[model samples]
Target: MPSSHTSSTSRAPWRRHPRATVLGTLAAVVSALALVLALPGATSAAPSSPQAPQPNPPQPVKPGEAWMGAGVQMHEGDSTDGSVPDEGRRNLVASVHGVDVSSHQGNVSWSTLWNSGVRFAYVKATEATSYKNPYFTQQYNGSYNVGMIRGAYHFAVPSSSSGAAQARYFANNGGGWSKDGKTLPGVLDIEYNPYGSTCYGKSNSAMVSWVRDFVNTYKSLTGRDTVIYTTTNWWKQCTGNSGAFGSSNPLWIARYASSVGELPAGWGFHTFWQYTSSGPTVGDHNLFNGSMDRLKVLANGG
Candidate 1:
């Protein structure tokens, strides 16, 4: 057995050169490293910073709830506001045609609206102190950028927060006014409470006081009186048709009818009239009861 042949273990190449085993191992390791670096999932970029949190959006208006004439449309079925206005009543030449939009409509076409003869717009900015329209920047800035006299409005939720608190929230968020010729004064949309009882369970005096507090606070912050948007019938039933706000705040009467109809209490005439919700165009239609020069004057804080 000792003389059989050259032993196979003694004839091994690595055994003859011990460094070749270590070099071969290192070469295999380097090949694997190159493969990992070549993979599609690999990256050499730096880490990113965290993004800021966005404000929460409000709950969707419920089945019986709405904004502008849409609210009135629902209210008219059970309530009395005889004869809703249609496109037949719209005399566009005599009055400024405008529209009001909320989150229900997302990412509107401002250019198309401009070409359609819409000269002004009111965008829903906030709902009480708890919510802001998620589409505010797009709706608010989009309208203004397109050469429309644009303003922001706050939906009243009297029960959830005080008037002062809500007003502050509105101003800090989007309901602000400037003397710029294109920006209309901010609006206070005090209308029927979609969440509960029509009057928000407030007595006539209490509701009136709430409205007063809101407009006062809003004025203190924005240096301009707010336009009050509401229905005549709701005002009659809830505030007992109080004429307290007539002298200061402009009335934005929501009457979906042939005429602007009887105003609330003290106001001798309505300033802005929302004539129709479902219109021939994209948004709710309105009439600014003045000429273009007068509308510009109002925007300039005349």
Candidate 2:
């Protein structure tokens, strides 16, 4: 989906609330004063002893692989994948790499994609209630045939159709998941409306209710939580910072910058990050947030 924003910063695993930071600072000060008071004959004017060596704070564990430039590996064919050669791959901050596609990409060569080190794919299946991608079957099956983890996504249109109706349509068509250890859970693409108003003219509460309806219905049918594909701005503007889905749904964040940026409410970390739309493969380029083992666990419905 086309996004309105451009730049974003890499996000930390946890977003500390401003109130929490203030309280933590005050507690530290109070604890230091109490320690001094407990010492024998200690006074505020007493000479300070050499401070104990403080251990370095632990660094956030990054993905297994570091970000590399796009041209690290290249193929001789035309950029049929919408991949932005020598550009999209830079500043990558994730471990595993993959691609997502739709009819807009035309016919993709899945084998070629796999040969280029693509490990997974998310093919667009349906949009709203009536529109289904014409090339969904070939794209979805072709990725699987090429031995890549595969999944399907639905583009949401909450104003035009009810969430339950769209979820049923998506599941029945191609978004359903199987425990075969190859298929990933379905994705709900809920971002810029792409039609009229940004939020499809729905209030934040209504939008949140619609999303809940969609995910709940999808879970009832497939027995798996749907992955949510969204940008931080859209989530905040449309959903009013709701954390309802954070505990249950996995996040697939979209940001076309050097960093992942602050995420929506609820999610501490994103499972998949759609870093760039103009990747060297097809459609959007993404990273699985962990190692191949974790990817397998996700595929196996863990």
Candidate 3:
């Protein structure tokens, strides 16, 4: 109801000069748009699609080439892939087909492996004391859920820490075992030192002692002797062909040959043989060296 002069005087800055205010607002909007286009990961180019192409992020080093038969391939110069396993060892000694996997093969399709006659699997759980396979839960539990008897293995790094300490780390992380008829005893993958000299620069007797400590500690923690995974050549080179663990721990021999040739001194025969790096399925293929009943017996702490 005020006079026009009084109303004009009381008008806000924008209302008094709407054209100038609109120009200022448009300038601010253009400046902001310019700033956004100037920033990294955004460009001033014409719109190519609904979204800009994101740059490929850097990938962390994956544990792809360091599991199971890696030592035989690295140190001893042996491989059994694509070679029919001496015309296939299923015809020679082992019957039950199995597999071993690591985080290298992420999120395994275990149901596919199970339906394809793989009755057992070993998943790498820990490396040294520091690394735990990031895909451990999926690989381990997935294999079990699909009715495959699965176990966990620790890749040993003796020089980094004591055997007992590494064993503890392994157990505390993912290498635990129970008599649930589905979980096999944890395995100690003590093969060639992938980091350095083959024997970890330890004397033969010292190497033997290190393995003994790891085995003892794992047994104390899980009430099960760990399955020892190694090549006959590596066992001889590192432990001086020590036959100490043969009787107590089951052997998971890594030999990519038609037959599981010579075993380490202690083990009369291998319970599990990693026969090929490339199997018919996703991971390394192995043989359980027995029937399904025998595999269950091992799982049940037999």
Candidate 4:
């Protein structure tokens, strides 16, 4: 009266062969599932794999606009034929040709730089503590009078120098950067010295902190952003990680190669490109900066 069916353990045929039968059933189900999966999906209308990206078509520049190649172009607005020199005033018939200069090695007179068809100039103003330029006096004022747009650079010290003190030393010590909260901002030069030593040490982290300290302090004093100059090495080692400063801080990248295309990627914006070391020297010496026609945009706060 309790139950008619017995447990599989009590049934000889079912219990002894249960394992094999269950295994066979599972195999059949798996094979059926495999066959179903092998067929196309229910939504078989989907297209095939992605098509290759289409190449961008070339386009011509509008009248009065010029292509400087390497993705730089410019438009010289309508203006009177002024006293900006016949050469500087000429149309941008070529790419943005430029060269960096330092008071240390540039030997050409300002007029020579102006006549050489160069555009903008960045002059190194200061070096690490206790090392300052002796020739910047003439170079700074020369670039101004020659109508060549100019900027200043500083040899940055480690943040361990006390941020405000480091900035003050360069700002007050005839570094030629603007002191009255106006004029072009400063540049913090951060790179490895093959045979030299620095308070910032050889670590890229130290260099990043030093750059931030120097730039912040300079801005505190001058009410303007300071530029940071370096190359692919320093960027990878330092700025790429910190992510504090904006790309708009007028980056002066030192890439002395065949072209600006050789510069590394991931840097969002580059304001200045130090393209050559063999251009007109300031005074028979190797200077340390560059020139760019589009630098006028930086000057005009573009």
C-alpha local distance difference test of each model: 0.67, 0.64, 0.67, 0.42
Query: For every model in order, what is the number of clashing pairs?
Result: 3, 6, 1, 20
- Whose lDDT is higher: candidate 1's or candidate 4's? 1
Residue 106, model 3: lDDT of 54
10 residues in a row with least lDDT, candidate 1:
1-10
**Range of the 10 consecutive residues with the lowest summed lDDT in candidate 4:** 64-73
Look at candidate 4 and tell me the lDDT of residue 237: 51
What digit string (tens of lDDT, one per residue) describes model 1 on residues 101-191?
7655555666656765667889888887777776678778988989999999888888777899989999999998887899988888887
Q: How would you encode candidate 2's per-residue C-alpha lDDT over 1-302 as one tens digit per residue?
A: 11111123232223333545534543442333223212322211222331111122112211111011111111111232323222223322224567776654445566656665577888878877787766667678988988999999888879888999999999999999999988999999887654457788999999999999999999999998889888887789889989988878888887665566798998877788765553212245677776555676688778
Regions more than 4 Å wrong, model 3: 1-65, 87-94, 279-282
TM-score per prediction, in order, is: 0.74, 0.69, 0.75, 0.55
lDDT of 3 by residue, 9-106 (tens): 22233333455554443334333322321232221222222122112211221232356655555666545433336433223222456767765455
* Candidate 3 residue pairs in clash (backbone atoms < 3 Å): 84-88
lDDT (Cα) of model 1 = 0.67
True-structure lDDT of candidate 3: 0.67
**Best candidate (score: TM-score):** 3
Candidate 1 stretches with Cα past 4 Å from truth are 1-66, 77-91, 279-282
Q: Candidate 3: worst 10 consecutive residues by lDDT?
A: 1-10
lDDT of 4 by residue, 173-250 (tens): 554344322235566665533222422353555656666677777877766666666566446654444555644355
